[model samples]
Target: MRLKVFEFDISNSVLINTQTQTQHHLTRTEAQVLEQLANHPNQVMSKGQLSCAGSQQAVMSESAVAKAIFTLRKYFGEPYIDLIETLPKKGYRLNISTPPPEWQQQLAQRKKLIILASCMMLIAAITLITAMHQYIWFKTAESPVRESRVVTLNNHQQIELIWLQSPKKSSQQVSNMEQKIITAFNLCPIVKWRDVYLAFSNDMQVLNISMQGYSSNGELLVRNIKTSDFSLQPNFISPNWLQEVSLCD
Candidate 1:
């Protein structure tokens, strides 16, 4: 590995100055220790870790690591000797002046790619959130508002009605009409009908009535009641109104 002016031949235990072509042979222990320090350039490694890296045994004393560092410094000589720095009560660090040029370039490229990928992910997330918000708003604008109520008839039959809100109809008037319809349903027997959906015109007149349920043979059925099909008089409901709205018939 090349570090500044020196080329460390870790496999052959040799260190050579590229400028002067001066070569220095190193011990196996010294080469292992140097390999560890060069691999982690500018980082501290404890004496015990360095010692284990060089020694063949399971454990080696810190003195062996210290001796290797001293020998390596003597070989490095004047200006380059201080490359290995010793910290008080801490550990040793190989203070590489500058990392290898190719390595530095690779690091820069990796960092740029990471930043670009993060920006793309952030943009995609924002776009998805905005699209979902627009979809929800569009659906809300397209669908009409409805008011739902559950009513129990005089005959103790329970039914749920979902009515579309009308611009001209007051809530109180709608409630009165809904109660009248519920009472009229009791005037005739209905089977297999429970949910009703009612629509109203802009002028507050009834538009349509749709009821849904399963038939006697377990088939799904929809019964529709039109405004012209039933009569709602000022003082009374027509006798045939219940028959007109009956699901069974």
Candidate 2:
């Protein structure tokens, strides 16, 4: 079974972060501990139980188990690390219950709030930039509407990646776009990409993505290269824009 702890997307032994669109390779011992804790969820699994979760022939010391857990926590960062709760003499558990009563409901609504916030921020920033420039003109492009993929060459350049949903689009088209996005992320700093944040409209058809770039004083540049098929209405599921999404407050 696969599991996600916060930003980390676990598919068998491989861990990927949907936000950064980057892969997180875990050590064998870390994988074992993560799987064991993820499998059990809210229930505490003793160090012995986690150590034996993988190869029965391979023995793991209690200290080794502790180290694995420590490393796993550090890798995933905050909030997520909080999910791994330690028990005195017992072991550890994934504490998804660490929240108010309606945490999942809050998660569902978070997408909309983020989209709204991003739009506002972008608009405000652009207005300020326009005031600074003597003149500005935007160009229109005519090309096959491909799903959004953002890559930046400098720290001062920000890019937007939008995934659209349309009746004319086949499921495969959406899949291909996502695969391309993932490939771009895999290319990393070499591809000129830095960071990522995920957001979606209230209807869930549109995705609002933010890619990190350069700061104004640091080398300002404004380029909104949108590649979206206007014929299609964006659907959150089709492009599976954030299909492998995992949340951490």
Model 2 lDDT per residue over 36-59, tens place: 777677998888888787566537
Q: How far is candidate 1 from the true structure (C-alpha RMSD, Å)?
A: 10.4
Give one clash count per candidate, in the order shown. 0, 9
Task: Choose the strongest candidate by lDDT.
Answer: 1
lDDT of 1 by residue, 1-249 (tens): 986678999888999988889999998778888888998888898887788784555355688789989998887878888789998788999989564599889999999999999999999988888989866555435456477877787667778888876676667766776776776677656546688887766644455678887777889888877664224423122446555545444
The local lDDT score (0 to 100) that residue 13 gets in candidate 2 is 56
Q: Looking at model 2, which ten-residue stretch has the lowest summed lDDT?
A: 240-249
Compared to the true structure, candidate 1 yields what TM-score?
Answer: 0.40
Q: Candidate 2, after superposition: displacement of residue 2 in Å?
A: 5.9
| TM-score for each predicted model, relative to the true structure | 0.40, 0.35
Top TM-score hit: 1
